[model samples]
Target chain A: GAGVSQTPSNKVTEKGKYVELRCDPISGHTALYWYRQSLGQGPEFLIYFQGTGAADDSGLPNDRFFAVRPEGSVSTLKIQRTERGDSAVYLCASSDIAGAREQYFGPGTRLTVT
Target chain B: AQSVAQPEDQVNVAEGNPLTVKCTYSVSGNPYLFWYVQYPNRGLQFLLKYITGDNLVKGSYGFEAEFNKSQTSFHLKKPSALVSDSALYFCAVRDMLDTGNQFYFGTGTSLTVIP
Candidate 1:
């Protein structure tokens, strides 16, 4: 089966610009999550969606970051007025509702705010 | 708040020798500890998890981890190291009782299995 997949494996944009990262979760996965990874660091949770609605957005750094998982399958992470500090790898993961909490990760989209 | 820590930034071991990567976690409730390995430029791969039952849990690639409740630790161990095992490892913790389903990951530890 196809694992979680992210689009635009790499993206480079200027500071103050806007960027959107996409994620396609595995078939039958009801839960999806977004995380950010800086150099030499582990992934930090960003947002999570259960079904068609976001169950938790507390991990989002600020109002500039927002995510949506419409139809409970594909998700998009949107950054507004991106800053150089927003440069990092954006990871997407998905898991089945009935299954354990082990998440399947995607290749991730590397966002570089120049 | 829940968190995990990989105190060691890097660890080196000769092939055929034992290897251990330390991990400790802090959570308000019983933790669901997990270990993941990531190769260069690849996404993190799940190795093992300690949900309940036995404290000793076996995982993929001849790996295992010991869950110590008192010490608040769940260290990854392998009896014999392999050069291929060299990679970055991350320790994660999740609270079973947290309805929000938030998970935390450590900084990560780089393991170099010398041949």
Candidate 2:
């Protein structure tokens, strides 16, 4: 079976620009999560979605970061007025309803704010 | 707050030699411990997890982790290292008792398997 997939392996943009990163989770996964990983650091949680609604989003750094999983299978992480500090590899993960704790990750989309 | 710690920044082991990656966590209640490996330009791959019951949990690629309640540790171990095993290793913890049920990851340890 295909694992989770993220679009746009790499994206470079100027500061203060808006960017959207998409993620396609594994088929039938009801839970989705977003994380950001800076160089030399581990991934930091961003947002979490259970079904169509976001169950936990406290990890989002600020208002400029937002995520949506409207249909429950696909999710998008949007950043507004990106800053150089926001440059990092964005990761997406999905897990089955039965075992929500064990998640499967996707190849991240590296976003560089130039 | 709940957190995980990987004291070692890097661990180098010779091929065919035993290897161990240390992990310790602090959480409020019964925790869910997990180990994940990441290759360059790739996503994290799940290695093993310790939920309940057994203290020793085996996982993919001949890797295993031991859950120690006294030490609050879940160190990943393998009998023999392979050159291909070189990668970044992460230890994560989920405090199920917490309302948020969010996962906390360690700083990560870079493993180098020298041939």
Q: What is candidate 1's lDDT per residue for B41-113, written digit by digit as tens?
A: 7888999999999999999999999999999999999999999999999999998878888889999999999
Question: Which segments of candidate 2 are over 4 A away from where they belong?
Answer: A98-100
Candidate 1 per-residue lDDT over residues A11-114, each given as its tens digit: 99999999999999999999999999999999999988999899989999999999988777899999999999999999999989722479989999999999
Residue pairs with backbone atoms closer than 3 Å in model 2 (clashes): none
Model 1 chain B poorest 10 in a row by lDDT:
B94-103
Give the per-residue lDDT of model 2 (tens digit) for A23-105: 99999998888999999998898888889989899999999999998888899999999999999999999998623368999
Instruction: List where candidate 1 sits over 4 angstroms from the true fold.
Output: A98-100
lDDT of 2 by residue, B8-115 (tens): 999999999999999999998888999999999999999999999999999999999999999999999999999999999999998878766588899999999999
lDDT, model 2: 0.93
Query: Which pairs in model 1 have colliding backbones?
Result: none
